[model samples]
Target: MKPSIVLVGRPNVGKSTLFNRLTRTRDALVADIPGLTRDRHYGHGRLGSKPYLVIDTGGFEPLAKDGIMYQMARQAQQAIDEADVVILVVDGRSGVSALDKEIANRLRHANRPVLVAVNKSEGMQHGLVVADFHELGLGEPVAISAAHGEGVRVLIELALEGYPEPGDGEPAEGDSIRVAIVGRPNVGKSTMINALLGEDRVIAFDQPGTTRDAIDVDFERAGRKYTLVDTAGLRRRGKVFETIEKFSVIKTLQAIEEAQVVILVLDARQEIGDQDAHIAAFIRESGRALVVAVNKWDGLDSYVREQIKGALDNQLTFIDFARFHYVSALQGQGLEPLFHSVDAAYKAATINLSTPQLTRTLIDAVARQAPPRNGLFRPKLRYAHQGGRNPPLIVIHGNALDKIPESYRRYLEHLFREVFKLQGTPLRIQFNVSSNPFADKQAPREKRRERKTTDKAKPASGSPARPRSAGKVAAAVKTKRPSGGR
Candidate 1:
């Protein structure tokens, strides 16, 4: 394992900006807004060939007792505990403040190597603002500008200076199924992760948006490796009040897209809302396998459970294919079945189908429900084959395939889902309409020539021709009559 570095500071200290620079990616959301990052965000960084792990944490407020600030403080402490080194970032332009001193005092007791990075120090001389940070007594502060890319390398090198070397370890497991747990705020997503992992790996609180960054925790269960991502609570667009929350929402959505399976945890206490359905629709549209986990089931009575089920059916009607599990994360109930469903859903989403089998299934489906006619023509459905996976795309190549009605398409989807046992994953059916090569092959000039030749064809055998002498005799008689009596 590479050395891990944690960035800790008060709010608006350019920690995120510096994190983006070190990771060489814009993965961590960066804006001018303060407190934009309310959780610990992890990324991989490299200085030349030296690769290391870096964590961007929320602003430090060790004394915050209640509300989201206290939660953020606790999350930062956890990151610091796991870090090989901690870098305290302070605003150079603003100089050292009481908060900086407080953070420095806290770090001194952390018993780990702590380095100070005085950010936004581009125009100032080398030691101008560095001296102001010396009162914190951690170390000589490295003057740098995270935005202008100055002194960042020196800061990272200092952080990694005393770290022990890595051993000859094998690479991490690559075949683990990435499961992202998402839901509205305070729906026990973190609690679910802790339950599954059998530890408090993530900070769980009753507050909304406690998790601002998508955190991936890897573990082994039943001899199979799994990575569970704990994401921020995704509120509806109109209800998202903070810029940092907006960034967190984006990160959550991205986590959904990247994961192999998504477990949408719903609060059993609340009524199924439109936001829940909206999230389900997104998961369905992303083509990822879905498992609806109705969390906090231990407290619900039979009647309440039935009502929640009814609401789910009414609100999320489009996602009925997703398997539902009533799991209580707090008490660790029903998780085994939930994971079983997840495994099945992942398998269904990625299963391969033979062309012959797909064609046969298509034929059977058409027979069961005859395709509706397009005007006067009944579309001749042709061959079907596997087009792709992760939603298992099946492409049907036929003439006039575009004329396939939406209702018939739904029928085919339902049929495919039933025949292939693709209940927990979305199935896609695409139509590739092929045109006939001979239908418009004749040229206009050729058609005209053919018409003329047919019109001027010789008379049938033995058919008599008109007499030319009869016309001459008629003309001669008319001329003599006109000269004599006309």
Candidate 2:
């Protein structure tokens, strides 16, 4: 395993910027927004050949009494405890503040290898900017600009200075599926993970918000590797005043986007609410496979279970494709079935369909119901094929496809879902209306056909005039070359 280095500092001091620089990826959300990073975000970095784990922590207010500041401080302490080396980032432009001294004192007692990084040190002469931070008394501060990639190498070298070299045996590298476990506070998310791993991998307490950071726990089950991301429970934004939970929300969202499948845990004893529905919708919008797990279902009566199922059905109609399971995280009841559903959902999300099969399905479905007609013209649906996966998408090409109503679209989506047995993942059907180059020529040809039909219908000199049937004239209009030459 690579040596872990933790970045601790106040808000907006460029810790995330430095993390992005070291990791060479914009995985961390970067903006001018303060307190944007409230949880410990882990990333991998390599200074030349030395690979290390970098953790970006929320701003630290060591003596904060209540609310979010205290929670962030505790989270930072946890990261520091696990880290081999700690980099304390301070603003060079703003100089040192009282909070910096308090954090410095705390680190002094931590007894871990500490390095001070004076950020925003670009363009200024060496002694002019770093001289004010001498009173920090940690050590000589490494002047660097995290955003500009200046002095980062020296800063890392100084931080990793006496650390033992990494071993030859690195972590297994391959296609490991990522599954994020998410729910509201105290919903047994952490408990569920601990039960799955059969160990106390994370802190599980009765109090809400016990887990303030998104932690990734990796383990192999039945020869299949999976990374279980145990995330902080999300509360509704109106009820959220703390900065820590806000950061956790961002982390949870990131986890969902990164993971191939998300398990939304729910409390069976409590009433299902709008927040749960909102989260499920977000997962659907992100195109991630979803598995709704009702936790603490060890002793629920059949009536209540049915009630819960009905509520889920009504509230999460958008994600009707998602799989639902009832389980007790504490006792591990129904876990096997939940995981099996997860595997099935992941497979469904990435399932590949052949063109011939998709076309046949569409043709059969359209023949059964027939697309709605617009006035005198009935739209024609040509064919469909798989456009993408991970929330499988099918693109259909046809004439007047843009005119397809939302109701009809849903009908086609439902049909495709049934045809593919696509459960536990949302399926999207897109219509691509092909344009005809000979549309002008088509109008003239139809006019000529109408004239010829009129001429044929007219009596020749003395013969009786024959009447034309509506079906023949309708067929003549229908024969307008199928849209788009195809």
Clash totals for all candidate models: 0, 1
TM-score of each: 0.59, 0.58
What is the lDDT for 260 in model 2? 83
lDDT per residue for candidate 1 within 1-486, as digits (tens), equals: 357788999999999999999989997888888888987776768776466778899989988999988878877877776667899999988988998888899899888889999998998897887988889998688999999999998898887775555321112456688899999999999999999989999999989988988999999888888889999998775687665665575567667867888999999988788888888987897677899999888977899889888888888889888999998899999999999998899889878899998899989887877788889988778889998777789999887778888999999898889988997888889999887777676687689999999867766666767657988988987767544553
Compared with the true structure, the alpha-carbon lDDT of candidate 1 equals 0.85
**TM-score, predicted candidate 2 vs. hidden true structure:** 0.58
Model 2 residue 404 lDDT score: 76
For model 1, the run of ten residues with the poorest summed lDDT: 163-172
Q: List the residue pairs that clash in candidate 2.
A: 321-424
Which parts of model 1 are misplaced by more than 4 Å?
A: 1-174, 443-486
* Candidates' RMSD to native: 14.1, 15.8
Q: How much lDDT does each candidate structure score?
A: 0.85, 0.85
Q: How accurate is candidate 2 locally (lDDT)?
A: 0.85
Highest lDDT model number:
2
lDDT tens digits, residues 61-146, model 2? 88888888887887788777767789999999999999899889989988888999999999988688888888989999889999
